[model samples]
Target: MDFGLVLLLLGGFLLGGAWSIWRADSDTEGRTGPQVVFAVILLTAALLASVSGILYLV
Candidate 1:
């Protein structure tokens, strides 16, 4: 339970949240540059967060 690990996981959540918003907005606007990238990055981070969180809880 290193503080640094917690911080890193939190950072991933923050990045994912931001990217999710950005991706959704871009999708709504019909843009396709960083939208997909953000969406993918967001999903990756979310998955990472879920795994990290589960491990932390365990």
Candidate 2:
């Protein structure tokens, strides 16, 4: 129940979702460069955040 942990998870979730949207947009626009790299990084961070959150809750 640490506030910092909660913030971490929330931030990760939001960033992941935002990146997902942007990734989709980039895909539709046919651009493959920094956006793709950023999307990957965000998704990875999101996954780590979710796992850490679950562990913290336990």
Candidate 3:
């Protein structure tokens, strides 16, 4: 099993979920676009880093 991938995915998931939830719970409706952008940023960064790390190991 790839531990780095696991960590990256879990971290991304937690961060993205937190970002969305935080945005949803907030009273500000106009800022969701930024929140979604942030979530995508974190998710993609984590995913790319994980894939590359795994590929390197493999």
Candidate 4:
């Protein structure tokens, strides 16, 4: 298991989530359009990271 890869993936997801939240709040409506899109990206990243971590454990 490569700790570096795991950390990298996790970090990327965290950054994406943060970016999404920021965008969501900074936009005019603050909860539509790109906000939903970015939110999905963040969720997908989180899911992938968790799956990767589980695989690494096993």
**Winning candidate number (TM-score):** 2
C-alpha lDDT score of every prediction, in listed order = 0.67, 0.70, 0.65, 0.68
Segments of candidate 2 deviating more than 4 angstroms: 1-12, 15-29
TM-score of each model, paired residue for residue = 0.49, 0.60, 0.52, 0.55
Where in model 1 is the C-alpha error above 4 Å? 1-29
Which scores better on TM-score, 1 or 2?
A: 2
Score candidate 2 by lDDT: 0.70
Which candidate do you rate higher for lDDT, 2 or 4?
A: 2
Q: Residue 52 lDDT in model 1?
A: 73
Work out candidate 2's RMSD over C-alphas: 3.4
Candidate 3 achieves a global lDDT of 0.65
Q: What is the lDDT of residue 58 in candidate 4?
A: 70
lDDT of 2 at 49: 74
Put down candidate 4 lDDT per residue, 1-58, tens digits, no spaces. 5875685579577667757575657444557666677777777777777677667667
Evaluated at residue 29, the lDDT of candidate 3 is: 52
lDDT of 2 by residue, 1-57 (tens): 796589576857768675675657643567567767777777777777767776766
